[model samples]
Target: MKKKIHGFIEKIIENDIKKNNQMILRTRFPPEPNGYLHIGHVKSIYLNFTLAEYYNGLCNLRYDDTNPKKEKKKFVNAIKKDILWMGFNIKNITFTSEYFDILYTYAVELIKKKLAYVDQLTKKEIHDYRGTLKQKGINSPYRNQNVQKNLDLFSKMKNGFFSEGTVCLRAKINMSSSSIIMRDPVLYRVIESKHYHTQNKWFIYPTYDFAHCISDAIEGITHSLCTLEFQENKKLYEWILTNISVSNYPRQYEYARLKLEFTILSKRKLQILIEKKIISGWDDPRIPTISGLRNKGYTPESLRDFVQKTGFSKQDSLIPLHLLESSIRKDLNMKSIRRMAVIDPLLIIIENIDLLHCENITVPNHPNVPTMGSRKIIFSREIYINRDDFKEYADDNYTRLTYNNEVRLRYAYTIKVTRIEKNKKNEIIKLFCIYDKNTFKTQPKNKKISGVIHWISKKNVIPTKFYFYSPLFTIKNPDLEKNFLNYISKKSKIKKNGFIEKDLPNNISCIPYQFERIGYFIIKKEKNKLTTCHQTVSLK
Candidate 1:
């Protein structure tokens, strides 16, 4: 069903290309350098780049750094880093500020033709004049000013003749049009603040709506694709090009933006979270930022697969994060080496003293993959298992070990509980068990067990802190709340004294591995050198 719909959209794209053969199809991923790129930006980047790839065209990375108040060079660098991490390379990296001189000349041309004028009305007054859909807007006092006077005033405004917000250059668009965006939209405004890229060369700057269209045309872009929010501005986009007499105007197309369950895509809200220290930073592993995902154990191949499987859509949709997670799990399950780690450890002591010595037991890197070889893990009189694996009493459905119940200690002999020990808090601290030596590999027994759990010898255990990370939000749609902070998950705990098997490699980097029944984790390196191993695990 989805393929048929995508094929239909593909045909429209093909027809567009056929009609405009003179202008080679070129698209762009333009983002404001005010904040870090999130998962939503990933979708946009993917869509534009994928479309360009399909048409055998080029994709440009254009930074819409028109707003100097909130943008910075740091954000520009971070955005570039993110795109590279996502395995995408743009044909060129450009900025809207690069064509400031050209845009200024175009603005002058508009003013000389009596199509624009410098207005002295305050922002509030301008808004009041630009009435709602049912009402016609009031004309500005200088709307009918002479072309020569308007040009002189615009030049003076550029030379810092007017204070910030005291003057603005607006295009003389329709005043009675139902679309509010066409009611003499402000093209350029005076901002005294220093820009991150262009610096203090000019005090006046062009707005996004004005700068974006011109930049696209200047770059010879064929498809000016954007989110659905810009659908209403399509007419104005064409109007700007028509009035300026641009020979080859780029075609504008809108698609639904990506919205994911349990993720918020608002840059303003994300900024607030960073400022308030609610998150570590933009690249915090808990965050959905591209860098964050990379740090959290996501591979480029996995991300590309995830995006391809999700495909494209016209209607707004909230993708189940499960789809992405499933892809990662499938990719990692084949690649990640198997290891034993007990987060909440429960002691299991052997009843027989004859099996007190440590024995080297070999285990496969992956269950079905033998070429990957095996690692030797020690088996001794006592072992550490998961606390959830045992109970004083059990029903038939309980697969793990229980009182007097026998279960295989994964890749080893089966063991039965002999006795249980409890502490002052009435919590079971340890269990006494005995292994069936007759079931050793040399003399295989015909006995069968319903469940098998992983374990490491207590004497050869590596005690360390395991930081378990879950999703930052408790709900599916985080942005739906009036205050996203209210939906943060407070139950996400960090265990400072988690345990792992002795067989785990020393000083492991951010390597992904399955923790048996406890899901996947990657080792997080810490600043302080703790002699004992410490790892942060992001559970899948």
Candidate 2:
């Protein structure tokens, strides 16, 4: 069962349904196919698809591929893959190029109705004439071109007579409107470049402002949702739909976009990171993209829970990145199996035990999840523990292994540090310890052992490389900085050598495992003898 969704948009939808019982609620997630989907896009996807499911309506996945210069078929396929990975089913996949004929017809209809005209001004001149918010726009000299001449020029534009930036189609709205978007916004422009889908069928393409609402109307979409940045463009959205001959006009709604701290959600900036080799690729674990999160061992359930926790609001706010980490931690805590790994190993030799002897011990996969079963691990006389777990001298609050103190070796027997072995440089090389054979699961009768540490048998250990990650940026709002690159964290990724239990399954799964006392980690096997372990999140 799913939780009831209650928001301002849901209330508006309910009122609309009440006004007209026959009305069918339809929504669509329209993304420009220029880059991969990030966490910001996931919020919109969750809203549109979940709302459709809750209201018993239909939601479509539409690609706003009007700009052929930056768009690609690979991006379209990647977006589809991301939506599927988020556990949402795409019922109808569409592209703005699919309705090129109908859109051109609609543009021609506007021209014949004297509502739109062809503009011969250069791009810069049009921008200067549009004016700023404090200044009113000036009417274009060719605004009153006769319908016949405008149609002839537009037809010539379609036939590739004009250069790419020479001419464009603009709506004939008021020049002095308070809203700048209403000041005769350009409807269509010549791209010259061949589209990935259309493939040189025509040289002209409709702008997003002109094609989006019409495309929504053609698909019978009832609610067209967008981020708050497009609140001003909503005027042009309604204007184009109202002037055209389309019957079904979709209403537009604006919500606050996701702004995460210590992250950059802009596709342009992400592209810069990729180009400059600041990171690996879009799937780099430090990035907020969907694929990156997946590669970092984040589950779909965790992302969905995060979206639900954030909800939908009209006011924009910067969300703390820790909230997202908390969701993933809660999810992995319940499902991940517990294992032992030693990063930065320190050798411990059991002087009292036989050097060649080994014993088998059964350990539960998860302490809380008894039904997950158990696995047997080899416990030999020689073992390796984390270097940080032991200290030559101890403080009163310290509860781990130290000189002359006894500590339990996790699920194995209790051991006491008898002496330390050091090198000529005064660095501790190893610790000689004696095990309490009578205290496997019981405490020593004469002494209190309050410390516990995880260890792996030297004879049954698998060498692995572990990757630790920190925040990509140093400051909270790096996106607000002029030079975000300056704030890039130098210690974002740190690699270390480690040893994992040898009884790991032959067929490695994508699911993360809780490395006892450390954090959750996902294993990646390499073609060589070594394996790589990626830390998903710290044990908080």
Candidate 3:
């Protein structure tokens, strides 16, 4: 409902209600319950729901479950959960299959009116006959069958008398029409799988094109919005509605679908990832699926802000991945509380500090929002700092700890490293430092501090696995490759056994916290087992 770039679609809706007293804005988010909802679907989801809300109308969450082979109740539930997570209230939950009886009758009426027929053409023959734009399509051998015969054949198809794909009912629209969707598109098909909603009561099912327009009409949806890929199908959509006695069928409008670089929006490709064990599951943090993003610490406000900022338009464009990140960064910068994590811990022994001298340091939960209060972190003789925060070598510009360099500890005393300890392989295992004995925050005379570094007491830290997640594909435009998987980022997810302050929250509830120098992270689970967490974004 946020004000975005106004396009012609908004004008159309605004003008429609302006003209007629009876006009009411209604919309629906009709998703095929074939797989879990993904990020691409988010734009359409919020658009439909928010538009209805903007007009003081209602939005329905409808599952276009005509294809029972891939559709399942679990998928329906998952989609519902995702929509709810987006912060919208869906009052009407309907399925296209719920109108199967009416839809079947409509098919019968179309056949009776000689607007449709059952075609016996094989799959290859149908494609061969559909003819390219340069050539006109040849009529199917069964195109002129009598309405009675077509009706009987369709009835037989519905009764499961024929094997799947043996025959299907097709609209008898102009075969030579330049729009291929109008070249006698399939209106009904034989899907023998038991539907999750209707069980085995029906064998033949209406195709997406056949059910979608009529469903919108039946629901009295004022503006049926779709992605630009279906723009060509609009003619067929209106034609079906006009011929089917839908007195007040909804008008269809097409806008660009959300496309992200290094991401595939195709449900089929996402299913491939699940099928081949390419990733963990539908909710893999690497995937563009909504559940995946939600688990990866994405907030709904950030998602909505992302879509609104991207703006709705008719022309499609591939969006940079950083645009999405920017939205998240903008959202979390004001909210995510600061925490300290040492992913690659280097022991720092403060030789001058002991149990008696050590004290608890209090830091603001959020530097900007004092209302979030503060948390206490302990300091002791033995503590851990990030290994990258120190090195055996240094330059004048080096802002972090180096051999014999003085640096300020975040929310703690200043220290000067005396020596670095290494193991047999020459890995810097620890650093010995002497802390300033001053009881107040102070700058060492004759030296400006290098930089502030975050550390935790070695005695009271909790070790947890932190996952650094990047794009699933290595290349920016991965979908261009014939084998998108060839560009799959092997290091899309990297796990580190990290240490966090012992006072950190045990339950995250999907809220991400900034880990000081590290990125934002949220607790995640795999297969019901609490597992490695994910980095939502980096500080830079």
Candidate 4:
């Protein structure tokens, strides 16, 4: 049995290598450096890198930086950081701009073969000629231009003779084809904007369709993996490669991108949010960006597990945010220390108690993971509890501090609510309770309690500002809408005043915690030492 198992594994490995010999199944993650990567991009990066690892292949971090107008160095750097944070190391790094001369030569070759031509039609006119969903489409007048004229015009385009968008080089594909991508797509266009890498060496730039395939060929990439949205363009991608004399013909494969509820994955919409100041930036914690998830205390292990469980599917699916959060909490629970914090503080006075001696309450860092050990908490006469935990009216089912309710002080003793103190306005200002110290569990007595609550020392409570973030948009699907900006929610906010226990010293840094009974939180170090965490509960 053991010999057979090893044989099967070896056979699979041998087949993978035999099928892709020279390049060894090389894959490239070609992201346009226009914005920071989001959760969907995370899925793509993980899938590409992991597949490379699976067949003992190589993965390259290739930037599809064709549109220099929207691309930036900051976005490229942030993308690199996000991929690294997700535990992927791409040794071969490249950019589409690096192969500009080679791609221009390829275009010249296509023109020499009369497969492409220089189009004089304006951008709007070209779009109109391409036809709409209800139209059969019309061909441009320049489609049948002379091959020598097309070559000369293309060279002039590279020489900066024409202004941006005045002329464009397009493939002479069938205009009446049902597939919209086949309708003589623009191969190259005049972009007078200064590029970050290539600079002013050329005035014309290749479109994504023209540049991407050439880039893959240049890197000797064997597998060009992308999202399913490009399925229609697969033919065009192959056409570009078949026309060019490349040593290896890379195959383009597409998979459905990850879609999550209560989030927007559209880069354009996300960019609008940043430009309009609807979000702090692309890395805003509210955003589904890789940086945002990292800042939210999500472990790389959790992200990997999420991608693994979701797997690769041909059809698009909407993943619930809770599924991702559950994965994060499952990992964090084993590592995060249990801490007590009162978000909405209410004074609790344990009357008839002496404050001279401070009691030490020992609590384990993790209950099931015993190796984490324990910490000491100082207990005193007065402490702060959540304001929502107490109420003036209640039914028999109410176990917490109602008018005269009885509850246990967690690891301490049981306490009975004796009276309620209020101001002249008849507000429930304070709760007066008497502790039955004899009923302590370690030193037991004949007493019982209905419920227990988390409390922090009033004097030890640190007042810090907390930033609470929610979904950036009001709609469930921000990408589906024609106007993404109109769905922006005004309720997404940042609060600067919140409190936590003083004993949590290490938490003063940008640390995170699973606040007992209140969901996860992090100690944010903005202007104030605030505890910022996402609220798991919803308004619904």
TM-score of each: 0.92, 0.97, 0.96, 0.92
lDDT: the better of candidates 1 and 4: 1
Q: How accurate is candidate 1 locally (lDDT)?
A: 0.81
- Sorted by lDDT (best first), the order is 2, 3, 1, 4
Locate the minimum summed-lDDT window of 10 residues in model 1.
530-539
Estimate every model's Cα lDDT from 0 to 1. Answer: 0.81, 0.91, 0.86, 0.78
Across 1-540, the per-residue lDDT of candidate 3 in tens digits comes to: 456444677788888988985777889999999998887899899889988888788899999999889999899999999999899999999999998999999999899999999999988899999999899888999999999999999989989999987899999999999887889999999987999999989989999989999999899888899999888888988889888877777888889989998898889888988889988888988888999988788899999989888888888899999999999989999889888889878898888776555577788999899998999888889999988898678887888898646788888788888877889998888888998767246665766788888888887687778889888898887767778888888888888887877675656655678889888878655565545557988876
How badly does each model clash, as a count of residue pairs? 1, 0, 0, 1
**Model 1, clash count?**
1
Q: Put down candidate 4 lDDT per residue, 1-540, tens digits, no spaces.
A: 222211222344456578757547688888999988988998889877876776678899999999989999999999999898889987888999889888988999999989999999999999999997667789898888888899899989989889887999999888898888888999999987888888878798999989988888888887677788898888998888888888877777677789987789888888878888878787777888888777766778888888767777677888877778778777666656667777667888888678664788787766787886777766678888888888778888887877656777666777777888899998888888888777765435455455887777766677755556677778787778888778877777656444566666554444446667666666655555344544422212
lDDT of 1 by residue, 1-540 (tens): 223323334666778868777646688999999988887787778877877776678899999989999999999999998888777876789999999998999899888878899999999999999998789999999899999899889999899989999999999988888899999999999998999999999899999999999899998887787888999888777888888856668888777777878877888988888898988888777777877777777777777777767766678888898887887887788777778888678988887745658888878877877886889888888888888888788887788998745788877888888888999999998999888887654325566565788888877776777765567899998888998899988754355565676666554664567777666667654677542332223345
lDDT of 2 by residue, 1-540 (tens): 656653688888889999998987899999999999999999999999988988889999999899999999999999999999899989999998999999999999999999999999999999999999999999999999999999999999999999999999999998899998999999999998979999999899999989898999999999998889999998888888878888898998889999998999999999999999999998999999998988888889999998888888898999998899999999999889888999999999999989789899999999999997899888888999999999888876788898746789989899989999999999999989999899987776787885899999998888999999888999998889989999999899999998998878766656579999999888888788578999889988
RMSD for each model, in Å, please? 3.0, 1.5, 1.9, 3.5
- Candidate 4 least-lDDT 10 residues: 1-10
Cα deviation of 94, candidate 3, in Å: 1.2
User: What are the runs in model 1 whose C-alpha is more than 4 Å off?
Assistant: 1-9, 20-23, 353-356, 441-450, 492-496, 504-507, 530-540
Clashing pairs in 1: 262-476
For model 3, name the residue pairs that clash.
none
- For candidate 2, the 10 contiguous residues with the lowest summed lDDT are 1-10
